[model samples]
Target: MSIREKIVKEYEFLKPEMIKTIGELITFPSVLDEEAVETPFGKNIDLCLDKALEKCKELGFKVFKDSKGYYGYAEIGTGEEMIAVLGHLDVVPAGDIAKWESDPFKMEQRDGKLYGRGTQDDKGPTVIALYAIKSIMNIGLKLNKRVRVIFGTDEENLWRCINRYMELEEKPSMGFTPDSKFPMIYAEKGLLQFNAIGKGESVVLSGGGAYNAVPDKFQYKSKDLKSLEEKLIANGTKYEIDGDTITVFGKSVHAAVGEEGINAIKMLMLALKETGVATPSLDFISDYVGNDPYAEKIFGVLEDEASGKLKFNLGKVEINSEKSLLGIDIRIPVTISKEEIVTKIKNIIKQYGFEYEERDFLRSLYVPLDHTLIKTLRKVYEEETEFDSTPLSSGGATYARSMENCVAFGAVFPDGKKTEHQPNENLAIRDMDRAFIIYAKAIYELAK
Candidate 1:
């Protein structure tokens, strides 16, 4: 059998072990937590890293975990050039426990799909990549270059872990991350997260916990609950009215694709405005933003051929007697400058008497489709899946943008289910099986 066939057989042989490893890793609930001495991100994250590195050692890869718990890596082979497969272990908070059919922390398989938090967003892909390394080793493939699987714990929030990893380690010759779509991601849009703060006393509003997810639940204090209820009912929004508080419920999705989720914060603001409890910030957002996925009202139609249009999400909103704050997430097209977007946003918010503060920003990444790394990955994807292996751009940010000569290869296929940052997040067993074959082949080709 050819080396590729041998690698596939090894992956099939290790399928059970791979599933078990993913299950074990998913049970850690490795969401970012209060920092401790040894566990900088949180105890759970540190524990997850320990477990991952332990598996790496068992697979005969030299393991290294940063003392600060920022990142970890496992490597095999002997060569001067190193290729990296980057992925993250941390997951976003499992919002609304009631929404999940099973425990988000407990991995459960039903009807050929593994369900849990981090199953698709990252943890599953990370494990699959490690096993790909194992498959190559199992086949006794002598690679001319070293292959390193770098595990990060902060891709869901800030990329601090990967940032620290770059500072401490040498840059890879070239790399890909199994954190996005299958054919390949050649371009990723720029990310800008900011907070718009203003003074408001008419209502107390607060919603959303993460900067990258659409706010699924929003609650505000209002004396006109009946009027708000009427408006909400008229608007056909899901909501609950409690004594003096109103809670609106909507779907949650990754901010990069925020159009898929109904913005509960926007709905709540509209209800408040209709009920005559208008705060300036609420009125401004309700009138200007109004649940549009693109910030077209404020920024105009910003688009580029490389990464498509600008995507926007009002991920968070807070209003109290003392002050009001609007947390915004924007994925800019690759062609636009950050200053151009930031200046326009600041000027618009200033019109409403709100102060705009940038919380975080990630510049766009674009590697030509004809690049050697892109060509190699695309070939692997086409040969493995027989799908149209066209390169694509993404609104979601990944570790691929964290370093030079890197792009996001996929654990998700072209027609695969997309559950990232959504309730009942899951990964299909069949999809993972295909990804293992693709990753194993890609690694061998890249490393060799």
Candidate 2:
């Protein structure tokens, strides 16, 4: 039998085990909760890592859980070179259960598709990677390198999970993360996180729950009902008017691919000034929103020519007497500096006499598109899918950036693939089987 056929046979044997594990993992709601002592993100993260470690032990591989709680491996090989298969266990919280045809956490097979939040994003790919390792082990493939599958915790928020992993272990020779679109990732844009704070007391505001996913539902409240209502309508914006609550409506869109949703908070804040509620801080926000004279000035400093995609999200907001707080999220292009962005926000806040603080600073992750790890994985995907798509850039950050010599792989296909981060997040059963086979081949080739 050919190498491909051998890998397929090994994958066929692991199908039942893979299905059960994936289903069990999909049952937990791994949403990031800052309120908990250990961090809600860490709790779900530990759960996924434990599950993975248990399975690896069952498959008779030497497993290691570091002091920081990240999962690691020591698969035997004779060479100094190491091959890594990086995949995250954490997933973005399912936005709304009402929008889903089925449960977001419960894995349901519909017309051959598996539907769940982490199914396509990372969990499904994680399972595929696991079985691929199993296939290589079962066949006793002799290779010159050590292959490790590192499971990370925080890909959605800050990536402390993978950072701790690197601190404990040696960097891999080459690796692939089945987190992005397939057929080789030639380039990924630089990712930068920005936190902007709104000053003083104000009302009529709203924002997003997660920085990555688009904000589906945004609500804003203001004490001055008449001005808020009038400005909303005058701007040709549709809004819901109740006794005292006025919520503006806009199409919610993925923050990275800002095609539809205009930020409701920005709209409401900009409206506050137009409706005669002007403060110095509002002027700063207006400029940042591309409304004032400083839009062009900020872009020159923030834009990256290599990636050529600049995206931003107005993530969160709170209205109070001391001040109205707004969380501004920015995905900086390749050329911007984290320090520069922070400095800009500080200057803007100082100009308005508002207090400025950086909540979370996420540095941009860049892997040259021409790297060998990406090119080899891309070749395998192209040969399998028979499609001619190029490696793509994403505004959101992943664990791939934390690990050296690593690039994102499958999980999300082309735009035509099933809805991800949407109400009915799911994966096809046939596709799950196919992914297992593909990952098996990828692991075998890389491990050998």
On residues 93-198, what C-alpha lDDT tens digit does candidate 1 reach at each position?
9999999999999999999999999999899998998998898898888899999999999888778899999898988999999998878878889999999988
Clashing residue pairs, candidate 2? 112-429, 113-428, 114-427, 115-426, 177-409, 186-369, 200-323, 204-221
Give Cα distance to truth, residue 20, candidate 1, Å.
4.2
Model 1, which residues run further than 4 Å from truth?
A: 26-29, 35-37, 91-121, 196-301, 311-327, 344-355, 415-427
Assess every candidate by TM-score. 0.73, 0.76
Q: How many residue pairs clash in each candidate?
A: 0, 8
lDDT of 2 by residue, 215-322 (tens): 555666545578777877888777787766777766577666654566665666777778777666466677555432213445553455455545656666665556
Q: Give the TM-score of candidate 1.
A: 0.73
Report, for every candidate in turn, its global Cα lDDT versus the true structure: 0.88, 0.67
